[model samples]
Target: MNSGAKDRPSTSFSGVIRQNFATKISLCLLMALTIVVGANYGWRRGLLVVVGGLLGVALYYSSFGFTSAWRLLVFERRGAGVQAQLVMLAIAVTLFFPLLAVGEVFGQSLQGFVNPVSVTVALGAFLFGIGMQLAGGCASGTLFSVGGGDSRTLLTLFSFITGATVVTFHLPWWKTLPNLGAISLVDQFGWIVALALSLCVFTALFVLVGKFSTRETRSLVDDGPVDWLRSPWPLLWGAVALALLNATVLVLSGRPWGITGAFSKWGGHALHAVGIDLSSYPYWAEYDFGRSLLGDVPTTTSLGIILGAVASAGLLGKFNPTLRISKRGAITAIVGGLMMGYGGRLAFGCNIGALFGGIASGSLHGWLWLVCGFVGSIFGVFLRKQLGDGPYRNTQPQVEAAKP
Candidate 1:
């Protein structure tokens, strides 16, 4: 009987039990938090939190990363990630154009994150590109990666917050710099024309990248059987999910999805807690900073993203947290985080808020951001090489489907 018991594969059973238990706990926590947020805030805010969680799950399962996408494109001439981004942007603009043209939905007035195409945007986005390469993640990347148990990103987040806070003192001066002001393609050309123009650009980029990239084009669908609950999702799945989620956020919140503003808010509150007076700052005074510090959509959604990522990781049986940063890696993380935080604020947003939200909404600044940020990323890749980091390293070979 003991010999038979030894052959029963109890270890596999225990592993299943553990995975199930972790999944259950994650779900329960998510449900409880949702209820709490609903009870304290409103149902709308609570729903946004749930959306944030799903964003995390989508981000985690797909391992979708803007940072790696840019680096791979620059270093290895691989464009799979870039292609996925194009798909996401195309989907986003399609959904956004008609809705924005209407101006109002469900009694809520809609607004795009259109900002000035200024020197500030160029400088900020350029710096942000370099930060992306150094930090190994962008704003959304850092948050989701932290939620996925990457301990190094934790340090990056802290430094990011610090950098964002420190930059607020100088933002007023940056604003004084030359700017072309806001340019909305939607407003200028009407939604129909804007949509067609945006789609043409996306198609052109898709074709051009496909032609030049060294990697062979691969199917977005996973070849292996995918367990929706536990297995990794295909890149296209992540792209579609993100685009839809952003649309949902716009419908619910009356504005496009944003991430970095919450970081600024958090940093502001932290400084206030330490006896610093922020009311004097023009940037802080322009809004209901006190009310925002209490709670807001961006804050709740950001929290939800982290929780959702944790749940996603737990469900996947990959929630092993480790603080294994080498000295060089640690330096880069801090420096990168600081640059990202500062650059994000200066540029009016990070990848999600500025590039994704801006472009989808037909803001010209979004296009400017793309050009400047990509240029900056080139220099960043060079810097990474100088620092002795493997800028061309490919962590996920299957995703790239590289040519021999």
Candidate 2:
């Protein structure tokens, strides 16, 4: 190990201090931003915004789908790999929009609101999901993955932009079906009922998936065969804890949970720096499910995700060094970025926008995105195999193995 690492060693006081500083500052900033967002949108809406984000993250994690993507791609988990994903899909199907009806405290702002739904919106959301999975990361996942120095995400991120653009520009041509729909599950149902129903469904699926799931080589962070987190004592509390935190964010944040808007913004700004015009892209025709309601440029949520990712990575000792894009990958990143930007516009959202934000708000569009995205993921998995996972990989064992 490097002398600096040896001296601080993460467990050491100095290391802990360093690790916490980033998050502390981030949390403070995030909360402040949340307050501002809440004030602008109303405290109830702001709170719901944060809670929605928290719920999305926790539910997604507890369901154990997104984490598997890490193992399959980063850690090389394959074959039965789809097992975790399948469970997540079930969870996504079950709780995503249903929770909207009951409400999540602060979500009162969204209590009566509903996203207009249509077949076109559904198709767009679905396509976006698949595109994100293939791209190897959704908007939120891409932020986290890229923060950890994964170069492959750059490819998918770019592809997402390209796909979005392609879809957006052609939106007028495909305006064949109802796209936006009304809120079915909004806040009228009450939080208790929503939480209870959500928990009930999540529990049933968890048991089924856990019962049926195999445990050959499991990591503690994700559920798998022989998983410790899955054990009775830890499982219930773990779920509750994560769920509570998610609910809290909703009470504070105002909007729904999301991670792609700002990320896509990075790609957008990059185009501008090089004299490329983002305005050339259609603003109305694109997939941005939620317009810039938060604020002008560098919205708090997107910024939070990027910084949160950075903070998370640094604390975990995963931050190494890399420009993260080069050669064919560089070309891919730019193209993919455009696609995602355009796609986000066309589809009305990216992974978080459509999947988490839309679903949480009781939008049918979110659910549609999930279905189509799953189909797209299969194709994405194939692409990852062929093109190679961007430019990053686990170096610990793989590095030693590479030794001749």
Candidate 3:
């Protein structure tokens, strides 16, 4: 194998030292803040934030994103990243199915996001898929990218919040649509049977993707001194880390990790600040759900993701932000973000909530979300091509992939 660049110096010793110290100080402060807030919220919540930060690090360092993985597979026939995702699913199911079947973890009731299979779920996921590609990121992707100082992603985040909040006012009518109620494989047969089923699906996808892919396969990272901390991580390792971390969230929070909910809550609050009464809507009007918007597990974790991403990008000397964006690109981001927000609400989750959390929890809706979301991404890709000066086009830096 060729030597990795991690061993070489990219700048003068003085600059390297300054950056290293800055990263160290930033990490210390962030950890301290997480501990303080988490302590106030509860130790479990605190742990979740720390884990979320680690997730940010893993996500940024590895470029492990749902949007790019799906896009590359659809447009270029590369399946390495997609295969890694299946690997993550397999790992998660093995850990989650048994724990979820028992119905409790650390004395708290355990549950999965088993939403009803319905027309809304399909359409919502499809819309989310299109939005993801157009916005240049999915829910998790938006947060991390913003943290990493991608200025365009900030627009996506704002529009996502706005769209999600607006949709909440209309959700009552959408729920009237016909649906097959929440179904869980764990409840249907048993955890063991469910795990087996999930494995079968994972294997089938793995084989099918590999068989059809045209790009040369490679390991996600190259081995070198100090690469573990500063260099991009392996995609396989990133998948494993995220799966395990998400399962940990389930144990601590008594539920799986989620995104978008916080965005909607934030958006709703913003609307309320301007005298818009969202509480009239069934969503925010329900019990203390509106107040919970101020701060909660989901919001905390989302914040931690941003923090972790900032630190991770800074360490890698990649935290560059710019205001310049093409007019068409700006328009695409707004439209994409709006669609994602609305779709996430109707579908009951974003990629993280519905797909990752759903499948890990052995919910059939997650599988359906995966299929529908991927299909939506196909259309999104075509739309992106038509949109002039698309920001995401060829903007992602090429990271070296080693021979497997």
Q: Candidates' lDDT values, in order? A: 0.82, 0.47, 0.81
Candidate 3 local lDDT, 1-404, one digit each (tens): 23333323337676566556646765776688677766677778788788788888888887788887887776667888899899999999999999888889778788888889888989999999999988879999898888777778899999999998889888889999999999999999899988898899899999999887888444544455437677778788798899998988899889899988888888877777788765667887763534544247788788788888878877886665568777877888999999999999899999999999988988888989999999998889778867743423444214321211
Clashing pairs for model 3 are: none
lDDT by residue (tens digit), candidate 2, 310-344: 45544454334345454655554454455445555
lDDT of 1 by residue, 330-388 (tens): 88889988998899889888899999999999999988888888888788867865786
323: Cα error in model 3, Å: 1.8
TM-score for each model: 0.90, 0.60, 0.90
What is the alpha-carbon lDDT for the whole of candidate 3?
0.81
Give stretches of model 3 more than 4 Å off.
1-29, 217-226, 287-294, 391-404
Weakest 10 consecutive residues of candidate 1 by summed lDDT: 1-10
Decoy 2 TM-score against native: 0.60
